[model samples]
Target: MPVYVRGPKDIPDTVAQASAAASRVLQSIIKGKIIKSIKDMSLEKIETKAKE
Candidate 1:
């Protein structure tokens, strides 16, 4: 999975930091594919497998 982080200088407000963290968590929950038994996998992995 791709990881995104706010640079120390980029985020200055406490509210913004909290909002970004929540957004990242929600995105992680909704953006992945549901596998049958193993954990949910990201769509990126499925696309890569299809190419192979």
Candidate 2:
């Protein structure tokens, strides 16, 4: 099933917190890949690189 999200003013505090957290996790996954793609194209290596 698909998920639906409502704003802070439209939902209770607990649901709003959960929705916000889910959004953050999705955003982080998308951003992490984009960052790795732009940096030396070294996404295939075993060792991890530090981000500054």
Candidate 3:
């Protein structure tokens, strides 16, 4: 994933730091997807999958 950090010149840009941020972001997105997938509102029967 393309990682970007918005900070002043004092902030260090490193591979490890970028990777860590990317990991956290990916995790958060997946968690949010799963949470949203489980919350379905429909009157008819429908097939669904979680966190596709």
Best by TM-score: 2
* Candidate 1 lDDT by residue in tens digits, 1-52: 9676955555458778899999886776686533444346578877774574
Q: Candidate 2 overall Cα lDDT vs. reference?
A: 0.63
Candidate 1 stretches with Cα past 4 Å from truth are 1-12, 33-52
- Model 1 residue 38 CA deviation (Å) reads 8.2
Candidate 3 residue lDDT tens string, 8-51: 44445576688898998798788764344434645332334322
Per-candidate TM equals 0.38, 0.40, 0.37
Regions of model 2 farther than 4 Å from truth: 1-11, 33-52
- Over all chains combined, what TM-score does candidate 2 have? 0.40
Taking every candidate in turn, the Cα RMSD to the unseen true structure, in Å, is 9.7, 9.0, 10.2
Best by lDDT: 1
